[model samples]
Target: MATFQIEGGHQLKGEITPQGAKNEALQILCAVLLTDEEVHISNVPDIRDVNKLIEILGNLGVKIQKLGKGNYSFKSDELNLEYLESQQFKDEGSSLRGSIMIVGPLLGRFGKGYIPRPGGDKIGRRRLDTHFGGFIKLGADFRYNKEERFYGVEAPKGLKGADMLLEEASVTGTANIIMAAVLAKGKTTIYNAACEPYIQQLCKMMVAMGANINGIGSNLLHIEGVDKLSGCDHSVLPDMIEIGSWIGLAAMTKSELTIKNVSWNDLGIIPETFRKLGITVEKRKDDIYIPAHTNGYEVASFIDGSIMNISDAPWPGFTPDLLSIMLVVATQARGSVLIHQKMFESRLFFVDKLIDMGAKIILCDPHRATVIGHDFQSQLKATTMTSPDIRAGISLLIAALSAKGTSTIHNIEQIDRGYENIDTRLRAIGAKITRFD
Candidate 1:
């Protein structure tokens, strides 16, 4: 395992480009299994999850070649779909939740899909029953192997579209069923789907590949099942989640940064939410950059001119993934704000570390916390800490980077699951951080 030893209180200054979206890349990579053609993807993030997914795909007989760093060409056009039992599949599949995406594509094209229990952030009980239920609605049968902890679903007649009302608008669940719907027979309507930017990109990509899809931005998706799909080249969108992290990092460290190639359109209310926390965001053409030397941020009032709590909800709302970073950033803001993480129950539990850093936070319950900002600042007091999850791990890095002294973050592999080359990139921006095995 690798740990990050960081010297704090230095500004993370300079201009840097954000990597492609991890969430989007995961889904798009699996879409490769839908067809047997050359599908080139650019701006790929060099991270553990993507590499793991590549290993899984390679095990599935998908040929992948690296043209250069951050660029690759992959072809599953002639994939030996029956060879799904490669050992690499189980090894790599065990470490990433994105591994579950293969189930839909493999089921649609090869008539069967086998996947082991995928791993991700242990923030709480991450359920796959929603995903498997979606698969059942799309005409596939699932049986669990208790010993192996893997699932095998076979769809010999190919998937036939059916009306599905998701139990919850699970983001991964929405992506899984959407992929399966593309090659199914007849029209498929999915209501209460998670229409986050990643899901929209999946639909748009499928549309480009001859899959008929409607309602790109809404929670209700209409996909007309097509017999086949061809390959196309696409550049993954810049990660807005990373953009949020940088925004918080810049504010917390009192630094200036210009994040180039930022997808402003996809940012939605992200910039506004950061602005609410009193961070200054400057937009230039395609880039949404942050200004230098931020003072303490302030709580923004609501539309009815009343104080409002910042919380996560479905799409077109605050993203639950960024809630942890937002809460940490709030500790540096001028006033108090409630970070309501409605999606996951235990995500708010990590705030105790912030309290240890002299942050005033009250964990009301599993889903909510009240944070009073700017009133407390302490010497980050060089401590050895274990990373809990991807979002929280990065947030800890930001906190440590803003502290007065040295901080060593153990198990940086959790951070790597999402952020790409984080230490190197932070160093480029004047942060003193080094990684060691």
Candidate 2:
């Protein structure tokens, strides 16, 4: 495996562009399976998970062409349906959670879809029931092959849309059902759907491809089944999670950094959440300029004068993905705050590694933690660590960059799965991180 050796205590300066959204890319890339026409996509992040999904598409006979860096054209004119039944296909599809999305488009166009148990971060129990339940509700037969450990959805008479009240507002599940319903025979209404920017972008892309979708940014979605869909060009929004990470890094290391082309309208409550931690973020057109937090920052209390609590919720609320970064920034702030990671149970386990670096953190339970900041008076001492997941990996990298001395982080493949060329990009802004095999 590869590792990152970072020399901490350096102040980063200059501008950095966020990578294209990884979550959106997963959905958009799989949506290509819904049409046989050519779809040109730009601003694609060259990351491990996305590339793996592209490879799976190629293996399934989708004709792919490289247009340039962060650009590609995909045409699913001919698909190898027989490959879906093979062991090689099962092994490939099982490697990433995004693979589950392929089922919807395949079931929509070809009347059948199959997937192995998808793999992803071991942060919590990510159930596939939300995805399969939607399929079963939409006039499809759902079955799990116990021997092969695979899930399959088949509609021999073709899919017919029906009203569905999602058990949870699961992002991937919402996308999967929408894709399946687009080509279904009747009207489909989805209540309690996930309305995050990722889902919004997917809806826009499908609309561009001629799918009749209403309510792009709300909990209720209505899709009218169409005869077929065409293809269109799309560019993903900047990675909001990466932008949040940069904000945390600048505050923790007291650096001056500008994040470029961040879709401000789509950022939701990310900037305000960071500001609650006392970081100064200036909006320069479409970019965010974070000044050096040298004088130190403090957590802001509520109007009632109660202790501040930063927690994750659905969209328009704090994102669960950024709670890790916020937790790291709180380590160097001037007050205490409680981080409640309600969506995932075990994401807070990485705090143990941060405590080894001299951070004052109390792991109250599996879902919550209380962090007592030292206000830069006590610098974290660098040590060897391992990355837990994509978000936690970047959070630990930010902590390592702000600490004193050198730190080695192993299993950075987790980091590369989301952030594109992270070390090289951070190096351009004056960070001292090197990658080695």
All candidates: TM-score: 0.95, 0.99
Q: Which residue pairs of candidate 2 clash?
A: none
TM-score of candidate 1 versus the correct structure, residues matched by position: 0.95
Q: Tens digit of lDDT per residue, candidate 2, span 66-114?
A: 9999999999999999899899989999899999999999999999999
Tens digits of per-residue lDDT for model 1, 1-437 = 89999998887678988899999999999998888878888888999899988887887778899988878888886676556666666777877899899988888777788888998887788889888888888889889988988888888888888998988988888888888888999999999999888889888888888889998889888888999999888789999999999988988888888889898999889998888888888898987677764445577867897654999988888998899999988877777888899888878888888787777889999998998886325434456687898999999999899887888899999999899989888888899999999
Distance (Å) between predicted and true CA of 340, model 2? 0.3
How many Å off is the CA of 20 in candidate 1? 0.5
Question: Best-fitting candidate, measured by TM-score?
Answer: 2
All models: lDDT? 0.85, 0.95
Model 2 ranges off by over 4 Å: none
Looking at model 2, residue 391 earns an lDDT score of 95
